[model samples]
Target: MFFKRPTKEVERERNQRLLEAVYSTKASWDHARETERAVYEANVNSELHYRSRIQEQKFLYLYKIARKFKVHGKLNDGVIDR
Candidate 1:
């Protein structure tokens, strides 16, 4: 059956298929962008949390060192007084 289909029907079918493809592609792109955005936000939050913990540890360590120095200084002063 080599009879060519009507031009109007052929054009309508082609346009419909194209529209469907466009919609599908757009949906997939949107989903990928959302996933990427979510992953980036998670990574940023993780980094901030890690940095906060490190800073807290550093503060505690420094506080302990300062306390030791203060105690050592008091001992030295007492010995000198004697």
Candidate 2:
């Protein structure tokens, strides 16, 4: 049998369903984007924290070396001046 043309009410319902599907899809996409951004920001923050810790360790190591040099330099200077 040939299919009958859809009635006005049926067409309106179909359109409404399509609009709802589109809105839900858009909402899902927006949520996914927001989650991705959050994850990226977290990764960036973690990397920065790691770099800062490395810098601090390097500074401390250099400071210790400088202190040792200063102590030895003073001793050498005292011997030379005597």
Best by lDDT: 2
For 4-59, candidate 1 gives per-residue lDDT tens digits of 76587776665555544444554555554555566775565465445445555554
| Residue-by-residue lDDT tens digits, candidate 2, 27-82 | 55555455556677556546544544555555455445445434221133535764
Displacement of residue 34 (Cα, Å) in model 2 is 0.9
Please give the lDDT score at residue 56 for candidate 1: 51
lDDT for 81 in candidate 2 is 62
Q: Which residue runs of candidate 2 sit more than 4 Å off their true CA positions?
A: 43-82
- TM-score of candidate 2 against the unseen true structure: 0.46
Worst lDDT window (10 residues) for model 1? 69-78
Please give the lDDT score for candidate 1: 0.51
